[model samples]
Target: MNIGLFFVPFFEVMRMLFAYTTEKQLVNARNATTGTQYYCPDCGSLLIRKAGSLLIPHFAHSAKEICHGMSEGETIEHLNLKQMFYQWGQQTDQQWQLETPLNDLAQRPDLLNRKLAVEIQCSSLKSTRLAERIKGYSQNGYQDWWLLGVKLRPNKKFTSLQKQFCSFSKDKGVHVWGIKKDEISLFYHIYQQDQHYQYSKKIWPSYSVPITTILNTNLSELPPKIILSKQSVLAEKRRLAKRLSCSEPKVMKVQTYLYLQRRHLLYLSEWIYFPSRYSFFYQEDLLIFRLLFQQEAKNADTIFKKFLYYRETMQRKWIFHRIEEREILERLYLEAIFCQRKAKIL
Candidate 1:
């Protein structure tokens, strides 16, 4: 028999034993009073009872060893909170309920009483795993869930961590709460399945927090707009053309006109007109114009000339490199115009 294989099983056995014994200790501690005697489940050392607080019974390690403390009380605190919230909701006539044995594979939540399930995550799990678990709950019929994050600290720092949890909500329809120490703060606009935004700096360690409240709101009702303008588009094209060093004659064609229009280049669209030749990019561009502008253009030739002039002026100072010459010159000729039009009075 390989000794290594035996070691693996032995380690597993020890892990199970530790977990089992820890769980037992937690249960006993929860039921014990202030003066009750307790022992560390893992190291068999005497445990220090910290008395019951508003949350639950607390204990610490008397031994200095690594595996001598009971941390499963966090899980117990979560369950207790769930039970407390469920009962509170029922008593207050809130539209919420509590379900037992949350079915994650069934995509069910840890606690689903009403339209949403609540998951209380407080582990240092990966974002993918957390996302998968929440997705499972959503797929199992719970569209919304509250994610409550408990931090290692109980202050403003924990609230900051709650904001960090918002990044995990992308596409997962979950809300986040930051519970540090004893305070509870909730984020309303942060949806459970919203898209995630990342930062270049890595400021904190990764952890998972369970959602606590699932609101009754639709995500699609939010706004959709990119903060770009006609000038920005024109500037980008000129920059690209200059870099390419292409001297191709700039053409104010239909495709270029439509591209700007579709991108909501209202200012650019007003001053430029594309030739009818590039009908495809034009058609797509016209869709955006149709949505934004009620009246169609009555004078196409004059607009096209103005657009041509604008394109030429914008590209006058741009110097294209050999590789980018053709592409950049062509792009420069495709002008974005700003129109002087009156706003429609609603």
Candidate 2:
């Protein structure tokens, strides 16, 4: 198996023979044989009975090894969440399948129904795994939704890469789900405005009704814009500023640019502090753009064309094809703001 395959997380654990078997059927079989009890679904290895207070009673492999269709390991939290999802799916109003494997794509979705497929994402994941899941579901004609665990591994603020490639739906729009304590929050109707992705984090508590309450949720009531609290914005900007100040060489270069432009290093606008995504790199470039914007806020068309002219000559080194797309987007955002400022002045 690819070491990469071992690292790729299952949306949930594998199905067992027990799922299809009745207790009476298991009671009639003898436990003396390797085939009598649980076995690894992927490799057919004999599994051990592991029951303890700290963990839910589940079968484990007799030896330490990786199996293709099995989970890396299901934590107590993982088991509980899976049970919640399965129980929720057992509602009378809908037909659902849990840990249903897609043989064609070789992937198992966490929960599947006619309208939706959900992944109980509880850990930091790799891009390859996410991409594979997205492509697999898309090709197979299933809409994938991700539910992130806020109660998971401490210290997960919003992620940039995940933000870049999240699952989308026509009815719900783009969304990011959060499981905080017992209540679940949905950040939907998302869009990137001025480079940063934003969405409404609307909370929906766990209810006793069918899962449709959450699944077929009506988001028309939520705000169109994701409004971050003033404190959060300022705090994030401060944290970013502190991080940027640590690199001595980068700081010196930015300071040199500020000095040349007769601008103060420590006194740039608060807007300058927010990064394009989580990063506002290319220190010299940012400083140049900041000074230019401040100088020509009332004249967008001229300054943007001048910046394009400058990019073709003096900044040819920064014109690497890999980065040009983002650079162009940022320049266009600056131009929009500049035009707004010009309109206000007129």
Superposed on all Cα atoms, the candidates' RMSDs to the truth, in angstroms, are: 16.8, 9.3
| Model 1 alpha-carbon drift over 4 Å, by segment | 1-51, 58-84, 93-99, 103-110, 150-214, 217-226, 234-346
The per-residue C-alpha lDDT of model 2 at residue 274 equals 37
Candidate 2 structure, TM-score to reference: 0.56
lDDT of 2: 0.52
C-alpha displacement of 140 in model 1, angstroms? 3.6
Weakest lDDT window of 10 consecutive positions for candidate 2: 21-30
Best by TM-score: 2
TM-score of each: 0.33, 0.56
Q: Pick the candidate with the highest lDDT.
A: 2
Q: Lowest summed-lDDT stretch of 10 residues in model 1?
A: 11-20
- In angstroms, the error of model 2 at 224 is 8.1
Q: Give stretches of model 2 more than 4 Å off.
A: 1-35, 49-55, 151-156, 160-174, 188-200, 221-346
lDDT of 2 by residue, 1-346 (tens): 6875774344224323222122322211112233445545456565555445664455555444566655434545655576566666686645776655555667766677764777777655555566666767877887776677754421223344445334344445555666544666677655543335456566766545566577667655543533333444466456446645785555555566567768766676654443332122233355345446667853656565655554454443331111233444355455446533443533
